[model samples]
Target: MVEKPGDSPHLLVVDDDERIRALLQKFLARNDFLVTTARDADHARRILSGLDFDLIVLDVMLPGDDGITLCGELRAHQTTPILLLTARAGTEDRISGLEAGADDYLPKPFEPKELLLRINSILRRMPAAEPGAGVPKVLHMGPLRYDIARGEMWRGAELVRLTATESQLLQIFSDQPGAPVSRADLVARLGRSGGQAQERAVDVQITRLRRKLEDDPKQPRYLQTVRGAGYMLAPD
Candidate 1:
C-alpha cells in the first residue's frame, strides 16, 4: 500500500514531458512524498537553488542538458540521492548512469510501486543524528564547529552550508568522535546498498567533505583515513 502524504520526504522530479512530470508528481505525492516538478535541467537547477530535496527523480532524455551530464554536475556539489529514469535498459547505459553519480536507475515504464520501494529503501539507509538529549551539542575541530542538536556546521564566525548527505556523514562521525567507521559500515549507514562501487562513492564524498573541514585536504587532520579499519573523525 502506498503511504499517505504527511511530513514526508521531499522529491524533485525532472522531466521535459509535461504529462510524465505531472503524473509522477501526483503519484508520488499520493504515496507520502512532497513532490516538486521541473520541466528540464534548467528548471531543475533553478528550483534546486532555492529549495532542498531528499531525493531527485531525473529523466535521462530531456530537451536541454541530458540527465547524465546534469547528474554529474550536481554530484560535484550536492550529495542528494538521485534515481535516473531512462528508456534504455542496457548494462552499459545503467553503468553510465551510476558513473554520472546516480544512486539508482529505473528504466521507463516502471511500476510506481517499485519506485516507492526504492525511495523508501534509500531513505531508510540514510544516517540520522541520534538524540543528544543532555549531551554536549557543540563539537570543536580547530576552527570548525559542529552542533549535533542543530545539525549545523560553522567555521570560525561563518556558518557553513552542507548538503544533506554531508550533514548525515558529519552526524555519524560526531556520534562516535574518535572511533573508526569502516567503509562497509558507512555505506550501510548512509542508506546505500553494500558494494565496492558504493565504497568508492563514499570515498568521493569524504574527499569533498574534507575540503570543507580540513585546512589541508591532502593530509586531513579532522577526517583521517585508517589503514585497514576505515575512517575516523578526531575533533580537538
Candidate 2:
C-alpha cells in the first residue's frame, strides 16, 4: 500500500457511477491518497465546504448542472486542480471541457494506469504554495490588502470574504507583482481543466476581483489586461 503523505493529498471524486467511484476511491487510496467520494456535484459541494481538497476528479456528464458548469463555478472561487472524465471523445467536447476550467481530461473506460499517471502529473505540476516566502509578503493594491500566506484579502482593516478559489487565484497573482500572467498560463498554473472557456471564466473573476480592489472597476490601473497577452496584478 502506498503510504499517505503527512497532509495526505486530499482528492474528491465526483461521479454518479458507483462502480467507477468505488474503484477509483480504492485504487487511489491504495496508491497513497486520502480520497473522498461524492455521488455528484451537489454532494461534492457539501464536502468542499468543510474539507480542503488538493484535487478534484469530476465526471463530465451528470444528471443536473453538468460537470462543465460546475467546474466553471468552482473555478470562480477556488484554484484546486481539476481533472475531467467524459465518455465523449469529440475534439469540441474535449476542448469544451478544458475551457470549463479542467486541468486535464480523460475519456471514460480509460486504463487505470493512465489515470494514475495523469493524477501524478497534475500533483507534480501544482505550483509551490509560497512563492515569496522570505520577502515582505503583504500585497497592497488600491484599497485592498492581501496576505498571501494567510490567503486572506482585506480592505483597509476590514476582511473581505473571498471564496476558496478566489483566494488561490489572488495568491497566484500576488506572488508576482506587476507580472503579466497569460490566460493559458493561468489555466495551466492553476491546474484548471477547461481550455478557452476556462480562460473566459478567469476574465470574469478578474473583473470581480478588480471591482473589489479598485477605486473604479471600469478604469482599472492595478489589475490591467495586456493586449493579446493576459492579466497582471500590479500592487504598489
Candidate 3:
C-alpha cells in the first residue's frame, strides 16, 4: 500500500454496494479514521498498490475477486488486519473466512456501532516496535528468533512479517512458555467474546503461526498442541 502522510489510523473499506461503501466511509471517518472506499476487489487492489492502510473492512460478496479470495491474496504479503462483512453466518463460512486469513467477520445487517467496535478492537491489537531499552529477550525455535518484548521474529538478518493476531498469540504463549493455554483462554486474550467461532478463529491463528515458526506445520516442533490441555510453546 502507498504511504500517506497522516497520524490517523487509515482504513480501506471494500464492498460492491455504493450505499454500504459510502455509509461505512462516513461512519468510520466520524470515528477519527482516515477512510478510503473501494467498490470491488479490483478497485481495492488498485488503491492498495500505492497506499498503506492500518486495516481493511472487506465484504465477502464482491463482483470480481471475492473477499475471501482477496483476503488470502493480501495476507500472503501484508499483515494489515482484515475484517470481513458477509450475509452468510454459517459455521463453515466463518471457518473458511478465518482459514483464508481474515482477522474477523461480521454478519451483515449488523449495527454500525458493533462494526465500529470490531474495527477498533482489531486496530488495538496491532503490535508496534518499541525503542530497545536494552538487549531484548529472545526465544528461539530452530532457525527463527523471536524478540519477546517487541513481538518480532527474525530468520537470520531478514525479519519475518507477522500478522497482528500471530504476534499477539506468540506473546501470549511466551508469557507462560511451557504451560498449555486453552482455546478459551486464547479467545479471551484476543479480546473476543467466548464463542465457538472465536475458538475456531484461535485455532486458525495457531495454524498460521505454526507455519511461520515450525519446520513442519503439520507436525509442529516449537508450537505444540497439548491434547486436551490446549497449546503450548516448547522453545529451544
Candidate 4:
C-alpha cells in the first residue's frame, strides 16, 4: 500500500491543452491530491508566485517558453520537485528533462497510475522525522502556530500547506527546541547518508522551510543558525 502523507499533497498541473489539463486535474484529485491547474508556462509562473506546491507536473510542449526552460529556471530558486510530461519518448529527451532539474518524467498517453506511482516514489525519497516523545503539542512562532502532533501549521485561523520534507524538518527542530542540531547530525537523523552533498541538500531544505516559517527568511528569528554550531528552533 502507498503511504499517504499526513495532509493531501498539493500538485500543480501545467499544460496548454485544455482537455488534457482538465482531465489530469480531475484524475489526480480523485487520487487524493489537491490539484491546481495552469494554462501554460506564464500562467504557471503567476500562480507559483503566490502559492506553494508540493510538486509540479509540467508539459514539455507549451504555447511559449517550454517546460524544460521553466523547470531549469524554477530549480534556480525553488527545490520543489518537478515531474515533466512530454509526448517525445526518446531516451535523450527524457535525459534532457532530468538534466533540466525534473525529478521524474512521463511520456504522453501514459497510464494515470504510473504518474501516481512516480509522484509517490519521489515523495518517499524525501527526509522524514524520527519518532520521539515529550515534544510539545503546539509550538508558538510569532503568529504562526505549529501543531507537532498533527503535523500541521497555522497562521491564526488559516492552515499552512507544508510539503513532506518541510513537515519533517519542523518536527525535527520541534523535538529539540532551543538546542542546536548540526547539519551532519541532521542528515543522520533524517535517514540520509552523511556527506557534503547531502549536507548541501539539507541547507536547501532549510532555506525553503524558512520561507514558510519566518516572516523574513534572510533574518530568521525562530530557526537560527549558530555560527560554528548548527540550527536551533527558538519557539516562544
Quickly count the clashes in candidate 2: 17
Best by TM-score: 3
Model 2, residue 76: C-alpha shift (Å): 7.6
lDDT of 2 by residue, 1-236 (tens): 13477777988999999998889989999888998889888888899998888889999898878899999899777778888999997767876765666767888889988898888877765535455547646888867787777777778778785544456578778778798889888777656666776677577657667766788889888888888879888888
Looking at candidate 3, what is the lDDT of residue 201?
A: 80
The order by descending lDDT is 3, 1, 4, 2
The best-first sequence of candidates by TM-score reads: 3, 1, 2, 4
1 versus 2: better lDDT goes to: 1
Model 2 regions lying over 4 Å from their true place? 1-6, 42-52, 68-82, 87-136, 156-172, 179-218
Model 3 alpha-carbon miss at residue 169, Å: 0.5
Q: How many backbone clashes can be found in candidate 4?
A: 0
Shift of residue 137 alpha carbon in model 2, Å: 1.8
Each prediction's TM-score versus the true structure: 0.73, 0.62, 0.95, 0.54
User: Model 3: per-residue lDDT, tens digit, 7-119?
Assistant: 88999999999999888888877778888889899999999999898999999999989999999999999989999999997888888888888888899999999999998
Say what the RMSD of model 2 is.
Answer: 5.2
Q: In model 1, state the lDDT of residue 226.
A: 95
Better of 3 and 4 by TM-score: 3
Residue 139 lDDT, candidate 4, scale 0-100: 95
